[model samples]
Target: MPALVVFDLDDTLLDHRGAERAALADVHRMHAAHLGHHGVGHVQDTYHAHNVPLWRDFGAGRITAADLKRLRSERVLHALEAHDLDPETFSRDYLARYAEHWRWADGALDAYRAVATRFPVGVLTNGFSEQQRAKFARLPEVEALAAFAVISDEVGVRKPDPRLFEHVLGLARGVLDRPALAPADVLYVGDSFHSDVEGGVGAGWRVAWLRGDDARAPEGAAVVEDWRALLDLLEIA
Candidate 1:
């Protein structure tokens, strides 16, 4: 068995996309007068176009998280032709609404409980410290289950970076009180291919990919469609 089991936060354990979609609804309703004619789909599409690239910039260290938020809001507003609306207000409102809908991915909490009962569990996620930590505040149960919740912004390195994985593995050594821990003795569970699978394999750790489609998991890695599948992969079910 692996010495430690690490989990990704957004989309893997939490319903991040679900919350974002709900939040968009809130933003659309709040700015109905300005955004009514264009429709919610247009606003959502515009937002994602700017949002994805801005996040890449942020991850690459070309821009700050604040810059990502501001730029995405501004660009989305411009694309939707909501000229009179304030970007700052739009950004703030969206985030506030997003926070209101925090929820766990289906069966994630149960999976966590199962694995954590047998192995030390930690969190490795790429996000700002405050924003990511706030997610725990909304789900105190999840917070209590983790041995450590490491954020990229806090450690100065993001996912897909070998350094971040090295850092977390080192911390796991201390958490488990095992100085001889090796990367291969850890199992990383996440939903992203580029960030989680590539990064975990690069770090020499075992990986269980929570891919909910027909896409195959990379060679030598476990593929799972949901939390229940993860339990089967671990042979704990």
Candidate 2:
């Protein structure tokens, strides 16, 4: 059976952390009156320190998506000692700034093209369709390449969940016009260990854990340091 290659959006193919840092710098500039004492680096570090865990909590069902959105900026502001800043307003500003900067992970676009030339490609991401779609708008090439995209908000399920993986497989079958498509025929690639690696492996799919030179894959897991490594792993000519 031919394989269907599915990718995670943030941090996998998209340079989300880079965009976040750039956006935070913009926000830091705007709120320099309140954040003047702290460098933009400090603000960026503080943002991720709180932001990553909050999203993890959301994914783990410890917090509602609403709670994640409402509290993320609040926590950052509290940590920055900007008591005067309104969390809601700051969040809006941050999002507005974030929207301006979206780009592919290093070598990601080329890797995507390479893989797509030989195999069908799709996206299975954990995010709102609106936001994720907006990202596609910024990168038309990505949008053009994707045969289908399954957003968790649209599907009512998130990664590391068997149901969501099952949902994505069903979608892939329909899109590829291969009714007999099996889980083993899919390759799920993403950056997060708990979500992408665990979810893909759990779903009985071939998984490529994107470590990006950060760390080695655990024992037997397939690890790719970057898109170039991924190309080699897939044996894409």
Candidate 3:
């Protein structure tokens, strides 16, 4: 049995994509006139295209969190030709709106409760500290369920970095009261194949790829569609 179970906070346990779309739509509506001929869909697509690669850079330690936040909005507005808008202000407002729309993934709380009862459950996520903390603040149950939460900003390193996984494992050992806990004694669960599955496996921990659709499971990894399937895979009933 695993000594601890670590989860990714965003799309894995929370409906972050849903919240992101809603928040982006709100921003688009707020700036529809300034957006010129570009529709909200176009704006969202533009932002996503830039945001994904920036986040990848973030995970690789090539960019700071502040850089990702500021540049994403700046690039999106530039693409929309909205030079009059302040990128920093737009990023802050977008984050506030995103926090307001926080929603848990279906069965997230139930799964957390179940798994926490049997194993020390914690979070290992790549995100800005304040923004991620605001998200957790909105869902007190998730915070209560987690024994610890290791965030990239706080640690000065992001996911897919072995150091981040090692740090989380150390924290998990303390929280689970198992000083002898090794990588094999923990299960890392997340939605991303590259960051979560590949990262955890590289760190020598078992991984569950949550919400993977029609994707071949990597060797020794579990691909699950939802929290219920994840719980079932963990034999938590």
Candidate 4:
């Protein structure tokens, strides 16, 4: 049997990190209506300085999702002394506006589509369910291609954790009732060494690293620069 192919969402297939930055830039353009001209660079800088560290804390399991979403943007406004800004209102608004500005890398959808045709495909990523599912719906129609995954908040766990990896493969194997596959049959593809590679390796599945930086992992498997390169790595060409 051909292997089951799993993928990461953020930098792997959807260029989520890029999409987020672009969305922030777009949001800056729109926020001028309320925040005023001075508020532009002010809010932007404060947002980055405050939000990035909070997210890092979140990834390290140092914060709660409620705190992550509610406080991140709110703190930015607070730091900038924009006391009039309503945290809850603007956070939701920012989500919608961000999604609107979402963009995908070249050949991203086509690459996933091509892989989906020949093997069982699933998305194994770390993201908020509502947000990630929205992005998934937008491009590659990931939900249509892969019916199973372990999203961060949804799964009550994050990547680089072996149990979460085990959970994803187990679900993919139809383990909800009867097991249909084994760990060896799935190869998880992602951009993070700790999350994707370590998680998959620890869980006893194959791994493919979607390398963005010069970072290297000692584990033996495939590595590609981007989605299109997946074709070559999988020898689909």
Candidate 5:
């Protein structure tokens, strides 16, 4: 077993996409007048188109989290012609709803329990501190099992920035009481190809890419389609 098993919270362990869709539905309902003739699907597609690239920029150190949040909201509202709504207010409201709608990915709780029992488990995710904490607070199962959860907003750096991964590794070593722990002893799992797999591999750790559909896995990285597959990869099942 690996000395440490680290996970990315969004999409990998938590159903962030589900939460986002539900939150967007809430936001759309709340702002139907401002949103004009656009349906929820249009809004979701427009928002995702604007959001995904900004998140990639965030992971690449090309933009700050605050900038990504503000810009994505501004761009999405612009695309939807929702000029009457304030982007900042919309973003805040959406995030609040998102926090409340937290859901676990399939088998997340079981995988977390299994991993936590066999190895020190931690979370390294790129997200707002307060929102992430709120989600964790709602899921006592995850909170109790995690040895650490390092958020980019709190760390002032995001992945695939090496600093965030290094910080998690250092904390994992200390928490696991393995002073000599090295990169090889860690296995990092996440859904994003750039942020999780590339970042973990760049940090000299083994990576398990939690991919769906027909996404290609990078060389030397494990690819799993679901939490059950991930558990199998970790030898937890």
Candidate 6:
């Protein structure tokens, strides 16, 4: 059976965290013009501090997408008391600017294309579809290498959930016009242990922990720090 390769989106394949940081800097500039230095950083700080928790809530199905966006804006506004800054309008404009500034990790495309020479590549990210599709637009090369692209919002399920893995795997198989490939034949590579690494293994695919600074994979999980090293781990080189 041909080995299928799956990848995570955020820090593993896409530089989302970096993109977010950069976007905040832009917000700082935009707000500083109107609100001054103290005012600008205030909004930036408040939003960054609150966004992760709100997103965690979002991931767990506790809130709607639109609600999360609006509330995030409202929280920042309330904290800074930035008058005339409407949460709804600010959120919409911020989303647009943020989406336009996506970046990809180094060696990501070369790594995928090298693997693509022999195996099918698919993306499985814990993100919304429209957001993800917009992200893909920023990295043209990465977009071309993948046979299937899956996101949590589009599938209505997040990583660590076996259903999302299975759905994406099915898409990869369909790309090859092959329906009988078991989950084990696919190789899943991701940055997060809790969601991507642990979850992929639970779904029966061989998991490869994409090394990041903040966390390590659970005991007994295989890991690859470099993108090219992935091919070597899979015995592709």
TM-score of each candidate structure, all chains considered together: 0.94, 0.94, 0.92, 0.80, 0.90, 0.83
Between candidates 2 and 5, which one is better according to lDDT?
2
Which is the winner by TM-score between candidate 2 and candidate 4?
2
Selected candidate, larger lDDT, 3 vs 6: 3
Could you tell me the TM-score of candidate 5? 0.90
lDDT at 193 for candidate 3?
Answer: 80
lDDT of each: 0.87, 0.87, 0.83, 0.73, 0.83, 0.75
On a 0 to 100 scale, what is the lDDT of residue 226 in model 5? 77
Candidate 6 residue lDDT tens string, 1-237 = 337888888888787766666676676666664446455455556777888778778877799888788788888767766666677766776676677667778877777777878877878888778777777777876668888777788787887888888888778777878788888888888888778777887888888887743245554357787886777886766
Clashing pairs in 1: none
Model 3 weakest 10-residue run by lDDT? 211-220
Off by over 4 Å in 3: 213-216
Q: How many clashes show up per model? A: 0, 0, 0, 0, 0, 0
Error of 1 at 184 (Å): 0.8
What are the per-residue Cα lDDT tens digits for candidate 1 across 156-195?
A: 9998899999999889889888999999998999988878
- Candidate 3 residue-wise lDDT, 43-133, digit = tens: 7788788889999987777887678888898888898898987888778778878888899888888888899888878888888888788
What is the TM-score (0 to 1) of candidate 4?
0.80
Tens-digit lDDT track for model 4 on 1-237?
Answer: 336888888777777656565666666666655466454556556666877677667878888878998888778667756577677766876777678766665676788888888777888888788878787778747777776655876877787777788778768767334376778778788877777787787888887777634446546556777776778777776
TM-score for model 1?
Answer: 0.94
lDDT of 2 by residue, 119-158 (tens): 8999888887799889888888776888897888888888
Badly placed stretches (over 4 Å) of model 5 are 212-215
Candidate 1: Cα lDDT at 1: 78
lDDT of 5 by residue, 149-213 (tens): 78888988888888888888788778878889998789998888878887888888888888733
On TM-score, the leading prediction is 1
